[model samples]
Target: MAGTTGGAAATAPGKKGETPAATRSGALKRLPLALLVFFAALLYSQIQPPPSKVPGAPGGPPVTAPRTRLRDGRHLAYLESGVPKEEARYKIIFVHGFDCCRYDVLNVSQGLLQELGIYLLSFDRPGYAESDAHPARTEKSIALDIAELADNLQLGPKFHLIGFSMGGEIMWSCLKYIPHRLAGVAILAPVGNYWWSGFPADVVEEAWYVQFPQDQRAVWVAHHLPWLTHWWNTQNLFHSSSVKGKNPIILSKEDTALSQKFLDRTYKEQVRQLGEHDSLHRDMMVGFGKWGWSPLEMENPFAGAGDEVKVHLWHGVEDLFVPVQLSRYISKKLPWVIYHELPTAGHLFPAADGMPDVIVRSLLLGDE
Candidate 1:
């Protein structure tokens, strides 16, 4: 009767299916293959890097260099990347940040100007890279070096200047001193926010002395920039989040999700490395007080300068080091300047994903 009713579940003892060992064996055999495919995809993605140039790039004309010297006898390193002596309307000078080599900004300027037929020159700041450090580094002294570099390079009567981070402060000094010489200027993530801070300059400056009383001028930055970059990053990010304007483009769902994950992971890793340095307290004080406030003090100089100097400013609304609030402050004060509040960028540009394009376009095409 059972045989006639015939259900496959009616198995005998010897044929009671294969043992669990067989199931375990099958999974173990396939595990290596699955991992191999996963890693292969990752390797393939890395092999093909992003395109090296912007869309519709008409490469710049050939460049030439003529021998020149600085008055201070300091041998400055520079590369001339456009047809020199060709009376171009604008000769652009790029100024880098503290402790940064010329190579840092060169990597950016070279690409843009090389493809756009624009004149660009970048050099190491004193105490950095190949350029000779000043016996004493001060706002005024550094400005002199830059002005001299421009003269030596014989860029042009009309020139544009772009500066980033600490370089922004230096750029301001140069702009103020050489008011008649510049045709335009652009500041990226300029760091002097002391005026906007709740604390007074005297209080802020005094705090710096306490934190780094003996180490004011000596070189003291986090050896590992990627790790110690958080303090700076945080300031920019907090500022970026606060920007309000006419219908800023919102991130798509996929980008929003992916960005959140990346930000969380990056922030954690950066914070974890923070314990290695004990200099944060002093660094912040000197940075916010002295280094940061210098530019705001010079803002008044732009008032009476002749010539229509077009100024363009772009900063991530999410920037942590230099907040968007600072950008907003400058935009309000300098009526001639146009500010673009980027919705999804951090402090690192020209190297970060979306920022390099915004920066280059802003510098090249104005605020539109």
Candidate 2:
């Protein structure tokens, strides 16, 4: 009797209809909303809804686990994420440029390679990541590194090589040093050709965008959006409907504002020079000295890579990094190559769409 108000009586808020049972019922009734708020926060954390990854910002492809070191002393950091079926005609080895890593191409490339059952191998070049850097490395030395990797991986005698930017020069050295091993080659925005063809203003500007990471904020505002640089160039590369109306042309006013900010940030982040210690231009200069510069030379792995071996060519029509005219002119000279000009694309190809299929068809569906 000292405290009849002890325990349940003390804890309970007996205010009219708000009995302990009634309060419990009210909490239960609101549980779903509470759960929803919790789940909504979780969902928001998982997906970056609209216009974050691509043009429309819709959720894009799933991220796959890239393979790291498999064999001991292999030392190369590689991504062998795509499934390689026995029937997969050949594995595609992607070589990234100076100071660049596998991430530069991996995000956009996985879809196309996976769809066609083609295996992909992208690794941080020596010195960039796990691999050791050779000072002022020549294309020959880089090619040796690639050859060593291929041999270690047992990719077989008929692998295809796809090189981007400075990587193309490394590939040329591979071809020069070990041509018989490769079945085909695809070069994207290579350096040597641009020297002969004359770089487009937009492409040079874009390269500057790539070279100067800090200038992205000002350049992006000047260009209006990050992807706009590609969009404006794509207009010349493809017909309007070819890209399935995924043109950046139709950006809404709100998106335009957001996109400009997005672009400004992305350009800054993307322009990192990977292997600056081993300048890509120096490799070219030496290779140029050895091979000698000519508008047409059999010394170019690209010049001879066309016939017998399958080749797929893509360059932005308005590509300021490399000339579309060079891409066209080169493809024309080579009878065995298939070329696609992205009316709205800049230097980079839209890997999500049908780009890989085109490469596969070019490789498999020949006169056979």
Candidate 3:
């Protein structure tokens, strides 16, 4: 009886097993599947991200505030602060940087603006806020838009411009394209372009290396493969902006704390209102795109204008967003610009308490 069970279990394995020849054939049968899987994975690895699709009308709540019409019939929305335009002794147009909107201006005191008679104008750039998106936006077109806005507002022939971060970067566009329309300009912690041919190779390399790896790739895509920009930034699977609103590591510890004074939730909410395509993506395209001219190549727009004209650049040595060397090079090239290097500050220094007032005073009153 035991033999019956043992015979089945201990008999030659061939009782229930395939022959060596059969096994060989089975392995051969699996070869195509193995190869198919291997090739499929290989192709997947080489595949690029799909191109970005057109973003529909923005998703945020409708903006109820006033909007100025541009030359091309696009409505440009803005936030007004401080004194009335007629009563304003100092007319300031504040420009916001990446991942920001019209409301991103420094939280300056109404009392301060009142006492100084300041009219602060902060506007959403094309594709931001309630402003109409411009598919053909270019560096020169943006500068002209600001100039035309001034004419439409009767802010006089020229107005003071104060821009920070990417906003600071756009001041260069005005300098290049519409300097005659500017009374004075101030740029704080502006971003720099790595592809600027004028920079010494070694210096540019050093500055470029300081950026976070993600930012380096973002910049590379923005400058080199611009067509992939929308997908690179929107796919969210890989690429995103370095200056992530509140978590921007590019700023210093102190600057991060200082920035807390302003309510950023609204800023971020409004920033995304128009989608990244027209705002951030367009910013990268125009900012890092082939500008054909660098800050080094620009002429001193205020050179012969005496004390009546001024160009101020404020940079902090502690800034990781824009390394000190880049600003130093700009200062060296444009000797007429009053360059202020803050030792302990970072990129967001302009947002510090009382700091906005100080910057305004310097521009309007000088060293009085």
Tens-digit per-residue lDDT, 213-315, candidate 1: 2122221222223222223323332321111110123333333433443344432322112121122222223343344334444454456765366677766
Cα RMSD for candidates in order: 18.2, 18.1, 7.8
lDDT of 1: 0.51
TM-scores for candidates 1 onward, in order? 0.53, 0.51, 0.81
Which residue pairs overlap in candidate 3's backbone? none
The order of the candidates by TM-score, greatest first, is: 3, 1, 2
Indicate the worst ten consecutive residues by lDDT in candidate 3.
Answer: 48-57
- TM-score, structure 1 vs. true: 0.53
Per-candidate count of clashing residue pairs (backbone under 3 Å):
14, 19, 0
- Candidate 2: how large is its RMSD? 18.1
Model 3: CA > 4 A from native:
1-61, 236-239, 244-248, 262-264
Angstrom error of the Cα, residue 99, model 2: value is: 4.6
Write one digit per residue (lDDT tens) for candidate 2, span 1-368: 65764655745675654678887888889999999999988755533212212111134222232333323332455666466635565587888754456655534345655566677788866545334334445546667777777887878876778887567556556666777777777766554433333345564454544422322332332234322322322244434221122245433333334334324444233222222222322333343333433323434444544456655565666444334565566566655455666675554452435554554455544421
Candidate lDDT scores, in order, read 0.51, 0.51, 0.79
For model 1, give the 10-residue run with minimal summed lDDT.
Answer: 239-248
Best by TM-score: 3
* Residue-level error in angstroms, candidate 3, position 108: 2.9
